[model samples]
Target: MTANFSGDNSSTDLLIEHRREIADLLQRIKNRRLQVFGLYATPIALIVTLLAWAGSKIFIWLHGDTPTAVNSVFAAAVFILGVASVIQGLAEFGSGSPWEDSETSVRGLKLDLSLAEEKHVLEARRHTPPVSDRQASYKERIPGEIARLRKESRHYRRLHLLMQWLLFISSAAITAVTAWYDPPQPAKGALIGLGATVTIIAAAAGYFKPRERAFNLQQTADSIEQHTTALELGISPYSAAGEEENLKTYAATVEGLRAEQRMREQQLDQPQQGQQQVI
Candidate 1:
């Protein structure tokens, strides 16, 4: 049963190709997770500050002329939270790259792939049922990637909902304060601050386009899922004469999907026009 297969060149090249693809997938997963973290974390920080400030205001109303310790504690909490929100937003926007950790993993994997010699690859091929096993492995990879994108899309959708709530609540509060209270100078300043806060949040939402991004990612993931399902069912392009032929179809189609996903990710990374200042 010893068929004289192309020994080193073709097999090694194929291994390298799959390794690079998996590396790219790892990178995509990492970037999307970081994107979810930053997108949601910034808003959570701001929301915490709002809640704490409201609580402090209620405390002041209930017990007028509070002690210095109480005032100092509230002031300190606000300061810390404000600083945290600013830092997180800056890190997310343009100040830092969140993909470094994933890139490190990719580098290590590539090194291992490079070290794989002809005999080593050949031995692996000899031991394994080549076409079916490799096709199954490839099939396994697609779902994980699609799930990652879908998960990130869910996070962004939640964020979009929360931002809408923030905008409405802030607007309502400002309107209520204006109608109900003939505010003193300080109260007027507070009202103005609330208005500014609402405006900034709205601007950020429009600039960031989390809703749109969520929609786009979800659509992309769905498209990938469809292709993967078709391949699994031996439909259309995936209907091949043999296991090897089908494997080629599967690999090529998956690579095309991955490239499309990468392009979408690049679009996600770029700041949309007219949003630069807000960004």
Candidate 2:
């Protein structure tokens, strides 16, 4: 029941080469994106952690018997850095995840190419037609792919949003404890931890962009499912066409949707902020 991407007897080296080239390009792009993300996260996390841990000393330096205003200036710098990190983190988050997107593209391409090869084999074997079991294989396979995509999309979406909400609640709790409750030294430490956590979460969320990823995945999956349904029903493109022709049409439609998804991911990779960052 497995479909091989290695083409049928007529497949040319040029075609296989082209597909490999595309896959390689996608992998490179994904690697570059992950590097960029790591570059952004590392320094931000380190500096923020340092500032949070030194909260007690900084507070003492700012408020205690220090005649000079140097501590005030230093504290301001830390605050600025923290804010900047949050902004950058969020920017990176919405910029899209090249790794997952690339994986999706490469996966779809392989499946599409394998299906194409399968069609060729079936066409060639017309004189000695395959069994009904062979025909049933593809019918079962397409839905399985659709289900996998949907499940993965939902998993990321839910995990990210859940984390974001939890951080927000933690932030709220810290703000409330410090502003209204007049906490002691131990409680004050919690405020510093809160600031660090929020900054990290903000940056992480920006980079992760779970909601958009999930939405795009769901859309692509739904589009493919629709086409599958149409072909099964013998609709316009699928009707009056031979099995091979119908499959080509289906592959074309699915590929188009996947291309759209790629374009959308590219657009997201840019530094978008303000209202655009909400989702």
Off by over 4 Å in 2: 1-140, 183-185, 273-279
- Tens-digit lDDT track for model 2 on 1-279? 123344432344444554565566556556556655654675666586667546745676556654346557656666766786665555446556433332233446556556656654554454233444344445567788789879978997897888779797988988787877565466787777888888888887787777787888898899889888998999977795577667666766776887888777765676676337545
What is the C-alpha local distance difference test score of candidate 1? Answer: 0.71
Top lDDT model: 1
Cα lDDT, model 2, residue 14: 47
C-alpha lDDT (0 to 100) for residue 63 of candidate 1: 63
- Per-residue lDDT tens digits for candidate 1, residues 20-39, read 65566555556656655765
CA lDDT of every candidate:
0.71, 0.67
